[model samples]
Target chain A: MIEPIVGRYVTIEVQGVTQRIYFEEAGQGRPILCLHTAGADTRQWRHLMNDSEVTKANRLIAFDMPWHSKSLPPEGFQTQEYLLTTETYIETVLGMVTALGLDRPVLAGCSMGGRIALQLAALHPDKFNGFIAIEASDFQPAWYDIDWFDRPDAHGGEMGAALVSANISPFAPEAERWNTLWMFMQSGPGVFRGDLSFYTRDDSLIARLGQIDTAKTPVHLIVGAYDLTCTPEDAKRTADAIPGATLSVMAEVGHFPMSEHPDGFRPFFIEALGKMPEPAA
Target chain B: MRSTLQTMQARLNASDHLKHLGRLFSETVLIEVDGDEFYLTFEKGAMVSLDAGPSRKTPSRFALRTDADALQKFWQSRPAPGFHDIFGLVKIGRGRIDGDMLLLVKNMRFFKEFMALGRVKAGADQ
Candidate 1:
């Protein structure tokens, strides 16, 4: 059977460079903008976008960042190395929001996306209806060496997939687990390291947590029970720091929750949506 | 432990799990659990040797070394967060790896499947 999702591209200028961003959308009503994890694409949200329960009353939108998937890199990309920073990341998301003319969309992201979600809550809470930061923490020390991710001798595809496979819960369906790994394996050269540059070395957001006014924009922090990278403990610390932030630890799920096991992730997602304050009438 | 490794070797050779992913993976790898060593040799994705070791004569592409407690936790059906993946073990300081990392990374899927056999064998023995 054919799915209801629609794919489209929008041209937006981010960091003084023009980029043609690819995004997929399904369903209708309040907008839910999704941001994929480091080195992954929009495919991570396929299951969520197809769920009738989610789409019937809400719209799900997922976009591939520049240099990832169908979204081609900006001009002069080949000459210089690709490195994502907080400034560039925020501009890209905001550029998309403005280009799409979204009305107070609920911003949701995983891992690197999750980190940016928290960053937005602290810096641009007024732009989103609510925030869902999955597998994120306020301050995560460098985990994997960047050299190991992209280098001359190591095969980027195999190394990236193998390193990430451990984050998948043993309970995740075998097919979905492999599917998640397959996408990681397909990432472009240096893309994984470029994205991780933001995740691992970004300035700490510890002090900024207090600035999030969850009353205006509810903050929901969800983490997988099996995410060794951003342990539930790390997310909890972030949640506690935010005055009204809510935290949920999903069992039998890992870093790639929506992709690795959407069935396990659906209930929690619906619940978070239920908590979203009704948009201004 | 010797018998367990033998059973693991037989299982790896019989399963089609690594069919497409292991064609070029021919290497000898070493595993050291709390100082007790086991040398495993894979020939074109099939286990050819499961040598229990004290001898330093056999060369390997790489070695994964961790304590017995860490191995026990990793072999659990539902391993703890930090022990679930080999990298996770290293990240949490419960494990160490040395030698040709590039070779190991290239044949990572093969090695991961090879290591996961411990979980299955441990469960079966229970």
Candidate 2:
């Protein structure tokens, strides 16, 4: 019988803000930050953290992003008044890394987290040993055009409510439904809408990606063949833009491939991490 | 009476697989509408209400309901050519369709047969 892998919460100070970051740390060797998708916390990477490959080769640090589960948003932060910019998110992540004294950790993110990973790599290439993004894409034009700040209660609007309800299904166990619903509700409407706006805004990181000094570090992109949220075409385009970036399309998977199809993705993830180029002398 | 009439009407609505429609009455069929929080069971041609809790019993056949408008369109074009083309538009989430997905590829006749029965529709295809 296999024992279940459990995670714990730790509080780390970012700048002046003391935020709680939930993480699952295991194994030894090179450090790697496993970032989760939007509306999801570190739990999404539970399978990866416990996988034999990760446990043997790298030290996995899975954490909840700010304004997400177990992590508190900065004080006086107004979701309706302030837009959640990708730059702000990257800065916070950098703060956490610096505060913890982590050595050039390899960065990995899924979906929205993936977008942040790309931004971090481009903005602060010196801080990371390598980067990996799953189902990440450039922001669509429609995202920035919408003004979610104008409506304070827009988070609880019909579409938001419907999405919330759909996420928790009757097929899931009662406990699972309760936990998932609680996270969605606690994340609140403004934060949710703000994040969506941040994601949809047209910020083409594609052109900026090639400028990253990948000669010293490696970059990888993993996508699902059936990812409805971000298609393989988008992943191909991103790969084409980034110099020497490798793209792997997993079979029979979707947006949350880490959870939906871990078995098929573990080997590829391990292979990519193993191939990370040695730091420039 | 009106509610019962509606239920009967919904059940009576002819599926392309009326020939094997009898199978629906004999075997248990689970219809999971992924988008909606609705999972229905049809046994002996009648709907059965199960407790809203987790159970060990899995369904024999699963049908995903994509949307109401697409369902209406398919219903209107009954006996229309190229019914299997509907699967192209329909999106399937994380559920198994009972019949052989390969047969649909290898033999177009079997494909048409499965689509004609309208036993299962992908959530996106509805």
Candidate 3:
């Protein structure tokens, strides 16, 4: 059985700008705040949001970042030079958590979102109850070049998708595959690349991972076996860097696990989310 | 067609990634378009020169062979699953890289960016 999901817009002033962010919510119980991948939006968690079992015991919330998916840019914000810095990204997430008044909400994020999740847990140790990270690493290989994004095709459609096409394994379901693929295809020029500015270059955790007390804020790292961008070895290295962080490698799926292979990723998702102490009353 | 590719040399040399990479590996890559060849000699990540046929001082490390249509489509930012990337094109039997496999593997992304310059330029062409 699955639960009906509701979508809504949140108005929050972040970094001195008023942003109308888009988010979705379903079910009720302990709150599980989900962050989506880079170059993507809240749709990544649609499967989890729809799952009856997940929504039954927990309140699931997912949001689209400014300039991503259905979320629009702040008025007067230059759309061309769009860049998401580490500081701004953190601030936005914190803004969402605070606006919702969620106490120690469990956080789950994938890829760009996943890296942010780990960083959020590490930076604000007491803010989160637990975290489920998917397809994330402190640093990724540089060869996955994205300079093509600086100059886009007639519509900036194709190259962005090509940059990570192989990351989606053939084993993924047809709908799942297209769902993930179309996100990249439809992205505005430089949107995906701007997001990568953080994913590949800006987000640094080597000096900070040691600061994360995994005992206090439980960290569950779930990665795909076929993720070329951030290999399993990379996840292992990241897990090794963090104290007491547990790692689970999902088979066959690649970078976009939540959207690409939710069924395969569900068990780990359940195990990790189920362990989080219920949200404060 | 060579003009389009030849134009990308400056963009590649100007790249922070390539400029930084050029400082690391001083190698030559031979790009064969149709039957014609252009040897891109790099010192560090900077392209010292583009020579048609062959060069006297430096020898190429590997040769990447692709046809005009494939290269043009790639340069158009067509996206992957098309012939947009070296590996993607290789998968479809549209292109091949011969010579030092390790060198190609070592600087895979660097070469990817280098090739993408043409595509970038194509995208920039209004």
Candidate 4:
């Protein structure tokens, strides 16, 4: 039985939709907003929440994306067209920041969360102190080509069910399966479709990588040697494109390396966080 | 391949506890597979195999199998949810645990810490 940590739930208005947001705070320093992957909620960071490194130095904030976990899906939420888009995600993040009174929190994201973090950094550079992207890539949009809005549901076809299942963790506990399923349903068919849509699209940050002012803030690219979803090669390319972007790869790890090898991942993450510049003197 | 295995055996034999454990067990094997390479070191006490695969090898009592790609994901995202809640969804390939599930669970923390140190060492060398 996982109990909710010390946190509060509030509503944020984004594009005329009232979205429910849950957040927890720990320690006291520059704020670091930890974003979760696409199919997961803020619960992903539960382990880090208790880490001495996280609790002793930095203020940590983690939340579910719109329509995830405790967050309610907005009316007419469409995944293919709207759920994972840069604009919608950025707006929700901005709204949450405004609601919480956080000033320029450093953003850290994993997989889908990483993509959102990059988009936020690129689109709204004023809102973040720095950005950390874990196993993320600018190549997602090129992986698939399907109209997510028109895609079928779990009951519709095998491909649809498989696609939907792919987003959720295959190693998820048995007890949470039904609850996760319910969350998926509430997220509607559009959410996964939107993810596929976003993943397969070609709008990338590779070309603009050099434009990012890494000297003013730290940008760290951490990857696992065996991540099939976002290959280390992709990470290497992205790192090479960005000026002074440090890349670290852990051996004997995979797509979800943090969970697969938590013992190894923490030190590099801590070192990266330590390198973050203090907020403008 | 056999020479690599011999080298690994020499390395393990050099460890006092492992050498002692080797005398107790009838048969054991220590295999490390990374990419296209495979190395096997057979011992007696406890059979352990660690697979960082782009290659395949025989299974053993305790196996920690992952690849470079997955390692990156794990590093970038620590403390991921769904393991406790969604284990079935994860694919645990190239891994085998032949005995003492309870013992494995008990020593999981130590094993994890050891592996963590191994990763750091590997990173530093690179």
Candidate 5:
């Protein structure tokens, strides 16, 4: 049975500064670290967080990155402009793992988090057990005028979300649509644009795809049919580059699948966990 | 054709959603319906100009192309799939969003609101 969800804050040092990260945990067994999409907090993983069976035997944990959700920036680390680079992002996740003492836990993330999941498995093939990437890819072929995010009178984060909301399947239920919109509206200003820099420009797993040992750290790429930004073909291409990497295209789902269609997306997510080699039995 | 363009421009000027568009400005997009081409230049979230055959001064970061009928359908009520949004139209093969993807993604809301103005005209025409 799934236990009650518990929330906590982990204080870790990044860039010679102390930062507090907000995270939620439930169930207990093999550690499962969940990361959210760009500009989105851990709320996207609500289904997995509350799953009765999945959480029953697995330690499911999700966290908000600094400058996102409740993970506010370090004291006196004042910078009006907030950007997350590949280095900063990976380092923070690694910091969490090290601090929590999770032993090569399975990593699951979507969009920006998905991008990180692929890199973590590749860079330290022995460090992670598996990689679950959703609506993510090695790289995006498009570029945008980022300065637009800094323009006066434009709320870049919210405006960016309106575009992201487009990724939601038109058939999404009203509750799911409102829930997604509420989270998007609550995100910190300019955070979405900052996160996209890492997702869209900074991180690319193409060159390092061969470095991943799928036999050890299996990779599963899941894309939704309605996620036009990162099409199913994109995930297929990324999976093909990595030997043994598996790809699944969900029907009627979109970019933010887990939350937008949690019940519908649960089975596919569970199947991914099923693929993970039993943790060091 | 000119009447449609003028209607779109007028609606853009009156829209509170489009009037205060942030980070989405400083972009000039070329709109091509059939062989008719023109540019919409945005600055600080407001549509500053709608000129003939694109703007030489600002040029166009991206261009959209479709026939007038499709454009009309896009402008009218979005009661069906494939005719709702530009990306939707692109997905169903009715429209194309090409050139400078950054502008397209970063300023997408600006575009969406700009197009959704068609709802007003749809009500008027009916």
Candidate 6:
């Protein structure tokens, strides 16, 4: 049987560079722009796209960040090192929204994506109707040395997969766990480290949390119980900082909630979506 | 601990994947469980020696130290969160690593698989 998800590409200008970004979407109605984690592709949203509960009334769209998966790096990428900064990341997401002509879509992101979602809430609250930040926080210190992820002596693929494997809960089905690892194994060389540049190096957004007008754009968070990197406490801290924000600490799951346990992640997402103000007709 | 280490060594050596993963790695690793020490020396991925004692003679490149209770929890087939992974143990203050962190991170995949052998043995024993 053919899958409901449809994949395509779009040409957009981001940070003064022309990029052909790859994206996948399923279903229709109010748009929900999904963002993937560091070094991961849009495939992380596959299960959500296929779920009837999510698709019946909402459109699910996910895009791979440049230098990740099918979203190839722009011209002259080889001339210098690839490092993700908040400015460039914000430009990319805004570029996608403009290129696709999404009308105030709800922004949903995980990890690095989740951080950006919060940033958007502060920087451009009216851009979307709501936000869903999964396994994200305002400030997170680097747990592992980024250099080890892309050294010549180590197999970057295996090392990346092994290090991040702990982010997934042991309770997840074996197949789902391995499937999630497969994406990390397939990640481009140095890409994981490059993505961590934004994740580990970014300044704390805690001071800026007060700027988020949640009354205009509601903020929702769902973190995993077993995630040591972005612990439930981290999500709570972010949630508590924002008035009218909702938070849920999921049990028996870890960092990659959507990929590692889609069945478990669905209810939280559905409830969050339900709470969001409906888009104008 | 001695018998379990023996079983783990045997299991690791028998796996071709582990052999390939560790082919370029060679180091002497110290494992300390509640002050009880066991030294495992590897040459090109094959475990050449497994010694049990508190010897100041053979120096180790790195060491993994955890209490017996934590080690037991980590070895379970369905280990609880914070015990399910080596890094998780470190994050939760249940385990500690000392010396040459780069060496351990360089061969992280191999080291993780090496430690996971205990899980296999534990499952079999059950």
Computed on C-alphas against the true complex, the DockQ of each candidate is: 0.56, 0.04, 0.04, 0.02, 0.23, 0.72
Candidate 4: stretches off by over 4 Å: A1-4, A76-82, A142-190, B1-126
User: Which 10-residue span in candidate 6 chain A carries the lowest summed lDDT?
Assistant: A149-158
| Model 2: lDDT of residue B81 | 18
Per-residue error at B85 for model 5, in Å?
Answer: 3.7
lDDT of 6 by residue, B1-126 (tens): 888888889988898899899998889999998899999999899888999869999799999999888988888887777898888889889899988988887788889988989884334545
Candidate 5's docking class is acceptable
Which is the leading candidate under TM-score? 6
Candidate 6 ranges with C-alpha deviation above 4 Å: B120-126
Candidate 3 lDDT over residue span A1-281, tens digit each: 43488988889988887889998899888889999887878888889889988889989999999988788877875635777888888889889999888888898988888888888888986888988888888877455455556562233444556556657654577689778878877776678878888887864776788888887888888887657677688899989998899998877677888798888778888988866666555
Mind sharing the TM-score for model 6? 0.96
Q: Which 10 consecutive residues of model 4 chain B have the lowest summed lDDT?
A: B80-89
Residue pairs in candidate 1 whose N, alpha carbon or C atoms collide under 3 angstroms:
none
Local error of candidate 3 at A212, Å?
0.3
* CA lDDT, candidate 1, residue A105: 95
Error of 1 at B2 (Å): 1.9
lDDT of 4 at A211: 70
Candidate 4 local Cα displacement, residue A58, angstroms: 1.0
TM-score for predicted model 5 compared with the true structure: 0.77
Candidate 4, overall lDDT? 0.56
TM-score of each: 0.93, 0.62, 0.70, 0.59, 0.77, 0.96
The candidate, 3 or 4, that scores higher on lDDT is 3
List the candidate 5 regions with Cα displacement exceeding 4 Å. A1-3, B1-64, B68-84, B88-126
Candidate 3 residues B1-126, lDDT tens each? Answer: 667766787787667867775456688888888877788888888778787875455578898988988887777643433354576566567888788865554565567767877875323533
What's the ranking of the predictions by DockQ, best on top? 6, 1, 5, 3, 2, 4
Candidates 3 and 4: which is better by TM-score?
A: 3
Q: Native-contact recovery for every candidate?
A: 0.56, 0.00, 0.00, 0.00, 0.28, 0.81
**Which of the numbered candidates is closest to the native, going by highest DockQ?**
6
Binned by DockQ into CAPRI classes (incorrect, acceptable, medium, high), candidate 6 is: medium
Off by over 4 Å in 3: A1-3, A78-80, A152-154, B1-126
A1-281 per-residue lDDT for model 5 (tens digits): 64478889989987766889999988899898999988789888887878879888889889999988889866764555777887788888898988788898889989878888888878866777888888878887543455555455656666666767767765566598668767777777777767777777764577888888898889998988777678788888888988999998887678888888887788889989998876896
- In Å, residue A241's CA in model 6 sits off its true spot by 1.2
